[model samples]
Target: MAKKWDLFEGYLKCDPNIKAAEVVTDYVENYRSQAISEEVQPIIDRLEKAKADYFNSLFDLYEKEAEYMRIDRKVKDIAGVNYYIKPVVDFSDINLINEPEIVGAQVLTTRLFPTAVKREKYSYEEGAKA
Candidate 1:
């Protein structure tokens, strides 16, 4: 890390356009500015990049959503005749005691993908609902 700072300092000093000596006079001043800049600049750059990426990703998602909805509608139309999407809850992995009562009461449902076996039996010969 120090070596990186040294290399950057050397580069700045060698640059004819910059007044590197004014900014980096003493060891403490040089070390502090470099450390501060090193820590801060990357974070700022990362946040900027992330913001831009987020908007781009959002645009991508928006473009795909209409197609996805169309496909989903087709699937629901086909599979939804005999079966409706059922919500299942599993508390096996959860630390129920540590969590709030309201949290346990909240229901999470899978409306998109079916992950259930219907209790009612469907038979072609019988043509029954049971």
Candidate 2:
């Protein structure tokens, strides 16, 4: 089955530095500030409702999943389960507003390098030859 596209994916692609919560806030604020025509207002309203429903469901799922994990961990710990063992319930790929930013300074640090060199080692003639 094809994967469902996430709403934050587009925003993150545009600006990787933005947090998921910021994307939702910006989207809602932008939608509210827009002046829609009478003919298209109903469609816009329906779209807004749909987006709200989608986000609400996602948030609900996130909360439940988190609670389940916490309970599962506690139960396992009480039962003397091995620390290296994985959780029984694997609920991966759930996107939440509280998730960390998509991009970080580490990403840039990997691609960039220092260009400076000591003046004593720097030679104008050698540099020109290269």
In order of listing, the candidates' clash counts read 0, 0
lDDT per model, in order?
0.52, 0.54
For residues 4-115, could you state the per-residue lDDT of candidate 2 as single tens digits?
Answer: 2344567658766767787678557653344243224645665598679978987787677686887777777887845554554454544333322224333344543223
User: Which candidate tops TM-score?
Assistant: 1
**lDDT per residue, candidate 1, 28-53, as tens digits?**
66766765675556556755986799
Cα-based lDDT at residue 78, candidate 1: 81
Residue 77, model 1: lDDT of 83
Candidate 1 ranges with C-alpha deviation above 4 Å: 1-36, 84-130
